[model samples]
Target: MSSRVLLVGIVRTPRQRWTKAEELEELAELTKTAGGEVVERIIQTRSQPDPATMIGKGKAIEIRELCRRYEIQLVVFEDLLSPTQLRNLEDIIGVRVIDRAAVILDIFALHARTAEAKAQVELAQLEYFKTRLTGLGIEMSRLGGGIGTRGPGETKLEVDRRRIDQRITTLRRELERIEQERQVQRKRRSRLFQIALAGYTNVGKSTLFNRLTAGATVVSDRLFATVDASTRVFKIDKKITALLTDTVGFIRNLPLQLVASFRSTLAEIRDADLILHIADISDPKVEGQIEVVNDTLATIGAGDNPQILVFNKCDKVFDDSLFTRLVARYPSAVFISARTGAGLDILQVRIKEFMEKQMVVKSFTIPAERTELAALVYAGGRIIGERILNGKRQIRIRGFAAELMRIRKEVRKRLL
Candidate 1:
């Protein structure tokens, strides 16, 4: 059964970044994503939030009466609430009250699939649970199916703080082990150039990955549909091969624990040779979403990587003039519809150009019987052609400088 949810947004004077209406709209979407139906949205304008109840005590009382009349089972706040505020609001409101952070964590838990993703989500949930140990009443913990009160919270209600802390430590150790294994693999793969896709939620990075590799990715219209990074080796024009990775989407705001736990997963983007910075051009908040991704990249120490601005979902864009203006703003950006495969040719050309710019042209010759050298050349570079000279195979190639240097050393060893 879908939960009947009442969403509350307390408007502070001169909202700094996002408007009240946008906040409420996003709140409604979040509630819906958590399998809840928003029955009402209430905006209370105030100089400041009440210390006890987020909205004033008098307003809380009135809202509680309305909830009872409407049979609303859940109330979600647009802002993060202090422990005291959460406890006091629930006591008077007579329903489950959850802040925005909890709702995001619950959605992440719901979508978690792989072991790494589950472990990360568990660690985040435990941290969130630790803070609410004292303030949220124990009785309310048993009440199920409400925002922030459901999923991992119910099973962990009885565990003491120390046990939860122990679990957190254990999870972190397990993740560290996983990260070590991944690091080893990355070291092995460093010879190959890597390109990573970083973007806001619901952008077409995964879709583009699927199209490029002929691999299936679970695509959806929901936010954060994929928590685990998806990576595949794809060839540009069937010669230049590089690792293409799809990373977890960036959001407007994330709790500190969530950010810390997910840092390991984003290491691919950090180590990438180039980043495809994708944005949903059709969304009204396209520019703001781009800024969010850039800020996240900077925070994670990946701000210096070269980027290709990819404006996806071009088919959905109705304003041609706006598109043209954006093109002028981002001269190198490629506007494409991954669904329709439109503008993909131009994107491929751009990728090839980036790849070529990173390569150093060279010429070498290998004996016809030296099949190993031929294979290495194919794996590590774009071959110009082969020639027959004095019963030997002459190869001309262009590849990354480091890879060419490595191959050159191997050839020297064989000659000696």
Candidate 2:
């Protein structure tokens, strides 16, 4: 059975750019995605958050009554609650009380399938609980069976700090090995143009990735449907085979625990030759979300990488005027619907054009007797034009600087 959940938030400033209502709605959506049934949303307006109960004592008492009346099994805060607040709320309301980070962590735990992804989620959960393990000994009794406890079971969580530290150390070493493996593989593909899809969560990044790579990655409307990095190959032009990676999506105010845990996974974005910043143009907060993605990229050390703004889901947009303004603002931006393949041709063309800028165009000729040398030249790059004259094969190719250099060295004796 789904847990009946109540959402609590504090509206610090009514004149804020975004309203408390919007935050609460997003919180509700997160709750639904986390498999909780939100029964009601309660907002407490205050100059500042209450140190103990978060929503203040009076509101806490009121929520206690509401919980009983509605038979609410869980209460989630839109903002993070300190250990004291979480314990106090659970004691007074006589139900499970978790903060937004916990809910997000729980969702990650739910979706994690691979060993590395599971380990990452577990590490994040432990890191979050390491500090909060105090004062909640009794309150966390219910934690033995619930969403937040998915990665680290009750037995592991109940252990002393020493055990958790040991486990964290183990996970870190494992992730290091995984990262090293990734680096070695990346070296093997150093010749390919690497592209990564980065954007706010549920912005159709996975959909676009699937469309481009002919992959079968699961696509859903829920936030964080893709929590692991998925990579595949796609052709930009006929001969330019590029590697495309779909990373876990970014979100507004993403929990620090997740960022720290998913560092290795996010390295795909950092290492990309180019980033495709996919945005849901139909969303009202699309611009804000785009900013969030940019901030996330900077945080992950991908700030300096080349990026192309891809406004996805344009088929869902009603206001073409907004799109025109967007196009005007970002002259190189591409609008496409990954679902219907609309504007995909344009996106591919734009990608090809962008990639071509980095390539070195060179002309080379190989002697007809050097059949092996001709094959090497063709393998090194896409041949734009080729002709045979004066008993020699002349070829014009566009390719990576390193590949061209290697080809030049291999065919140095066959040069014409």
Candidate 3:
């Protein structure tokens, strides 16, 4: 049975504008993603969120009446709410109340596939619940299906909040172990130029990732399709190799707790040599989405990384005048449609050009028995030219200066 949900969006300040009616539409989509139907939407404007209720007290009373009249099972707030606000709201509404963070967690729980992704989502969920446990303990102990109250942890919600705390601690330790393993693997792949795909949720990052590397990660029109970091290698040119990583998407008002929980996963983007910031060119909120991605990147300490602005979904933008305006604004941006494979060659050329600009050219000669060294260069860097003369192999390789130095050290170590 689809749960009937009432959505609320309270604009705290004029500075925090909500021009994107699409956000409400997207919220409805998200509700559908979690198997809920948005029966009504309530919007309010205020200088600050009401301490007792997220919306104005009058609005809260009205929403309570609406819930009763429409038989709304749950009320979903578009912004993050404090524990106190959540408790007070639930008390008045007499229905399950949840903030945006909890809604995102529910979607993540539904879509989690691999063990690692499942663990990460569970960890995030537990962290979120830890803060809201007090409010939920009384309500969740009685209610079953509602906006924030759905998940595996539903029935055994909190036998004891301390037990949940202990589970979070254990999960963090387990995630740390996994993170250590990932660090080792990252070190091994450090020789390759790493590029990460980043953008607002549902902006075609995974689609482009699949087109670039032929990797079939879950591609969907929904938000946060690719939760876990997925990495694959692609040849930028005959003489240049690059590894591309697809990471979790960013959203407006992203939960800080979720960010903290996924820090290890986001480290891939932070450590990348280049960031491909994909954007949905057709999205009316493209500029706002760009700001959100930039803000999230800054929060994660990846603000200094070089980025290529990729204006994707060009196929959807039919107005040539709008396209021309976008191009004029971002002259160096690459326009593409990952779904239709349009403008991919231009994107590939741009990436290759960036790689070439950063590359250091080197020439080396190795004994015939040292073909292993040449193979390492081909795998770890880019082999531009190679020749076998007498009993030695002469090779020319081009790659990042740091990678070249690392290769030189490895060759000397192996020979010594």
Report per-prediction Cα RMSD to one decimal: 2.9, 3.0, 2.8
- Residues 77-109, model 2: lDDT tens digits: 888889888778777887778888888888887
lDDT of 3 by residue, 1-416 (tens): 88889998876565545553467777888788888988999777787777777686778889999999999988888878888888888887888888778888877767666666666777777778777765653735743445555544323233356587788888788889989998999999988889999999999999999999987988998877778889999877676788999999998877777788788889999999999999999998898799899999999999999999999999898899888888898898999999999999999999888877887889877786887887777765667898898998888987688888887888888888
Residue pairs in candidate 3 whose N, alpha carbon or C atoms collide under 3 angstroms: none
lDDT of 1 at 138: 63
Kindly list the per-residue Cα lDDT of model 1 for residues 1-416, writing each as its tens digit: 88898888877765533577787787788778888999988888888878888798898898899899899988888888888888888888987788888888878777777888888887887788677755566644443445565544224322466677889889899999999988998887888889999999888888988877788988888987888888898878767888899888887776667888887888999999999999999988898889989999998889999999999999998998988889898888999999999998888899999989999987777888888877877666878877878978888888898888888888878867
Point out where model 1 deviates above 4 Å.
14-18, 143-145, 150-159, 362-371, 384-396, 409-416
TM-scores, one per candidate: 0.90, 0.91, 0.91
Q: Pick the candidate with the highest TM-score.
A: 2
By summed lDDT, which 10 consecutive residues of candidate 1 come out lowest?
A: 150-159
TM-score preference between candidates 1 and 2, better one: 2
**Candidate numbers, best lDDT first, in rank order:** 2, 1, 3
Clashing pairs in 1: none
